[model samples]
Target: MSVYHRPVSNIWWLKRKPYILFMIRELTSVFVAGYCIFLLVLVYKLTQGADAYGNFMVALKLPSSVALHLISLAFVLYHTITWFNLTPKILVLYRGEERIHQGLVAGTFYAVWAVISFMVVWLVLGV
Candidate 1:
């Protein structure tokens, strides 16, 4: 005879879901890739002819298409941040044979992204 026990305390984060989060985060990466490929294909089709371009726009009007884009946009935002957060683990940065903190690296990535975003907007909008 055996019994399983679940913790009752509200340590919060430890008690929360992980597998679901992992799946969501992984799916976000897939969406990011798929979204880019989809845009590329749409561009290619639009360049082919008016009929093909009309078909693409018609597909966009479908409910499934709208849902896909909405989900993709949400996932993409999460993916971007997660990618920055994971950069330190993937790359080796040693000033004098010592590893750096992941947060520091991720912060740097966020800073760079912000600066580039600002610059691009400034150039595009003439600000």
Candidate 2:
């Protein structure tokens, strides 16, 4: 018996807004993983000693490295915002038998994120 197979175009995902956004989100993950690996390398360099860590920091300040970091930061932000927006769909909340609004749920996540980020900045700056 022969199986029926549907032909699909290479750029099929680009045809729709949702598909394009989904593809962009998936692509952002690569940059996110790359950034994670970069952070891990930074940690490793720190463990190697002060001189190695200092050199690593110096390298990171180079124009090419700064550009790469900026690009990665943009992708990471896109990935994070998209995922947070999706949180409501993935997690349904209830407040005493009443279904909570999706916007509220997503906003809660953003609020928590902002609080944590502010705390991190405060700690890092020692202010």
Candidate 3:
């Protein structure tokens, strides 16, 4: 049989985008890890005494670091939303018909997040 194939298009990431996106998402954690390391250093500096803590704070307040933080926060927010959106798929609990229960799955995920948030605020505010 003679072959007849269409040209591949840029929009056709159906086959590649998932892997590409997964790699992008995977690498994005570098910023998250870096943030944690920075926090740990801050903690260490605080324990070392006030002067060290002040120096750490001043270093963090540098313009370049401030910009890095803003960008990392944006990346983190995007990562969190995308990650939580996929939580329902992994949690995979059902309450009704498959299509109808999808809402339940999503709702439950958000509900848990809300509860955890409440607990966090209560702890932080000493309520």
Candidate 4:
């Protein structure tokens, strides 16, 4: 009988900076998904009644909930930035015979993200 060896180590992803960042980016989705569920719960609370919604708002104001939100926010920002950085690889642009620079591609994504974010804020605030 032949013994099989495991191909991967638990710390394999931490061997390099890029690998560590990639793992973190992938992990961020969990927090993002949790936040989405949290938002859905908030909406459900709103549907229940003003009192439920008020209770949810108060719960969100608790220090533990605030810390969780702040941590989730950090993960979300890291995920967004890393995703934007990788956009150039997935989105190829050619102008005539020449391919566009990667920096330009990432810059364009960042610009579009900023514009869309501003638009969302403007609409939300009615400003």
lDDT of every predicted structure (CA atoms) = 0.85, 0.94, 0.78, 0.93
Residue 88 lDDT (model 1): 80
**Which 10-residue window of candidate 1 scores lowest in summed lDDT?**
7-16
Instruction: Give the per-residue Cα lDDT of candidate 3 at 49.
Output: 94
Per-residue lDDT tens digits of candidate 3, residues 1-127? 9999989877554478786777667667988998999889888998899998888888887999999999888777667767877776777754475544555777776788799989999997989
Q: Model 1 segments beyond 4 Å from truth?
A: 1-16, 50-67, 116-127
- Model 4 C-alpha lDDT per residue in residues 1-127, reported as the tens digit of each score: 9999978988998899989988998999999999999989988998999998998989988999999999999999998899888999989989999999988999998999999999999998989
Between candidates 2 and 4, the TM-score winner: 2
Kindly provide the TM-score of model 2 when superposed on the true structure, using C-alpha atoms: 0.87
What RMSD does each model have against the real structure? 6.5, 2.3, 5.0, 2.8
Give the distance in Å from residue 84's predicted Cα in candidate 3 to where it truly belongs: 0.7
- Residues 44-103 of candidate 2 have per-residue lDDT tens digits of 998999999999989987999999999999999998899899999989988999999999
Worst 10 residues of 4 by lDDT: 52-61
Which runs of model 2 end up more than 4 angstroms from their true locations?
1-5
Best by lDDT: 2
Q: By the TM-score metric, which is better: model 3 or model 4? A: 4
Ranking by lDDT: 2, 4, 1, 3
How many clashes (backbone N, Cα, C below 3 Å) per candidate?
Answer: 0, 0, 0, 0
Per-residue lDDT over 5-123 for candidate 1, one digit per residue giving the tens place of the 0 to 100 score: 97665444445588557667878878888998998998899788999999998999899999999988899988887788888888767778778877788889999999999999999
